[model samples]
Target: GGSIKHDISVPVSRMADFIAQASEAVTARLPGIRPVPFGHIGDGNIHFNLSQPVGMDKSEFLALWGEMNAIVHGIVRGMGGSISAEHGVGQLKRDEIAATKSPVEMAMMRALKQALDPKGILNPGKVV
Candidate 1:
């Protein structure tokens, strides 16, 4: 079974809340879904992962990747967390970051990207 991966960082103060609320939120959607959340508690960077329910088909559980990401990421956003903690915005998260950053922030990023890679040749779609 493929596990959906989310590397997110919330404030140290909100780490506990993020875990509790996110666990509750996802479980509410799919009963018996096991949350295997763990990581650096001091830094507030958590590899908030969910393992499939017992006896459920692996493909079926894998099919919920997008929904599970939205549910988990939504909670991360609500808590002012970075969707990517240790990792940068690569192919997997380029599109999703727009929702996380403000329009002005995004625009500034674009401007910087343009200044740095005027020809649009560096890691083409790996970031904003």
Candidate 2:
């Protein structure tokens, strides 16, 4: 009934693998799940969209949003890719973005954030 959209990017070398692996992963999780991978190939950005299977209840299909995100994002991470390739990381992925970063990377990111917003006024706590 509705779709879950992923704005992800991987290295050019891994584009094909990303698509294949993600598609296979989701299909295994929910048979009949349609994996729509399309976008700027040159930039390694694939707007991975998932359409619910036919005859399924809309709410039932939508309930798998988080699980599907985990499935696809895991592949993206394994490929050394960005989960947010185009649109900024919104509420759906804000926590995930931070959780996936290494401690060192998180520390560096916090240092930079501190430098940029000493008072924590700008989009306070919106990013890692």
Candidate 3:
């Protein structure tokens, strides 16, 4: 239950390539590890989960989040993928998504949010 999850997506054409390249990079940097790469390939979103190398400390293993995220997401974005796929934005990726999405798209999303929640009290600052 303590595992971190990143719901990322890539273009259909680049799905296989992204998985191969990303898995290769992560393993190269962190040896003796097995990446549990599994997700929706049709939509190009792979839940690239990594378990600690045998006998490795969990805390020490998790301390590599920043570096691992940068490496994985960098490849995903380089291939035109959204680092946050089906999983709606939370505190972790709110600013990151906002910075990348276009103004028009963001405006439309906000309009929809306001329409459904006119009082701005329903889950405010959660999705929009």
Candidate 4:
């Protein structure tokens, strides 16, 4: 059995709606996978995890990581929630953030990175 983990944060008021939408989206796209969502609802952050179905191939299930991220993160984004909650973006979410962020925002981030770490010495190729 393998597991996929994702974290998202939405407004406290919309926590219930976000959870419903997210669950529906995941189940609709991946009927066989069982989503085990849990976290601090007080702040509206959810640590959504998925477990591979019975008799499912580990590699095959793990291969859905990116696809699941897209499905789940899309729902989170549409609900005005952050794709990365608590955990800062790393290589795992670099492309997702780039795709989700605006061009101007991306440019500003790059500028800041370049200005602060001209040689890309700090955490090279991690974020931005």
Candidate 5:
């Protein structure tokens, strides 16, 4: 629990500025937090994770997963970044995909899913 990982997307135009502001916000809230901010700059997708403050217990730090997600994801989403980024909508982020993806897009996706897996057995109860 001593580390956290947040994969998020930002608009290409706001990538640099968004990361800067987000990192600053994290540092301000949790001094000494090790920000391991890295990822696909071309796609404006950044994995902004943080290691525990030096010498802090990893388990205790990891307990802040939801809080860390809130902070980082909040900032990233505010800048129009996808919280799921490159990770396809497995069970973990299905609802998030639904929330972010458009209706027409979702419909098209459903059609593709049905076409590929007519039995609906593939990845059942996952994406669609």
Candidate 6:
């Protein structure tokens, strides 16, 4: 009854391929894990939720969150999609975003953060 969810967005044209490939990737790596994907298809965003397999330990299944994120987010990135679309990067996805973002993009983001919130007081340890 437990599940881990990820928010991802691909271009409208690549939505179908993204879904198929993502599902295959997850299922391949984690057999028996149920991938229940849903969300704003019109806008090309998907809330990909992986349900724990029958009789699986909730904590153990949930522990694979990062691994599943990588599988799904990799497909999204391959399709030129964003791992955190609409939902800005927060603490939950900070490390993943850092890992996925390019050096120049991260630099620009850090620069903006410094320029706007030099004190690191507003939402500290987030976004940047």
Q: Quantify all predictions' global Cα lDDT against the true fold.
A: 0.88, 0.88, 0.78, 0.84, 0.78, 0.86
The window of 10 residues in a row where model 3 has the poorest summed lDDT is 1-10
Model 6 gets an lDDT of 0.86
TM-score of 6: 0.81
lDDT of 3 by residue, 21-53 (tens): 988998999896667778887878788777777
lDDT of model 1, residue 118: 90
List model 5 lDDT by residue over 1-128, tens digit each. 36687777888999888878878877887788888878888978888788889977888777777777778777876877777777645776667667677899788878888898899898897664
List candidate 2 stretches off by more than 4 Å: 103-125
lDDT of 6 by residue, 7-126 (tens): 888998998898788889888988898988889989998888899989999999989988888888888888888888776677888887877789998888889888989999988987
Which lDDT value does model 5 have at 13?
96
What order do candidates take by lDDT, descending? 1, 2, 6, 4, 3, 5
Cα TM-score per model: 0.83, 0.82, 0.83, 0.80, 0.77, 0.81
**Candidate 1: tens digits of C-alpha lDDT, residues 32-109:** 898888989899999998999888898999999999999999999999998988866788888989889899978887
**Per-residue C-alpha lDDT of model 2 across residues 33-113, encoded as one tens digit per residue:** 999999998999999999999898889999999999999999999999989877755567778888677888767867887
For TM-score, candidate 1 versus 2, the one ahead is 1
TM-score of 2: 0.82
Over the stretch 48-99, how does candidate 4's per-residue lDDT look in tens digits?
8888878889999999998988888888888788888887577888888977
Could you tell me which 10 consecutive residues in candidate 4 have the lowest summed lDDT? 82-91
Q: How many backbone clashes does candidate 6 have?
A: 0
RMSD over all Cα atoms, model 5: 2.6
Taking every candidate in turn, the Cα RMSD to the unseen true structure, in Å, is 2.2, 2.4, 2.2, 2.4, 2.6, 2.2
Give the worst 10-residue stretch by lDDT in candidate 2: 85-94
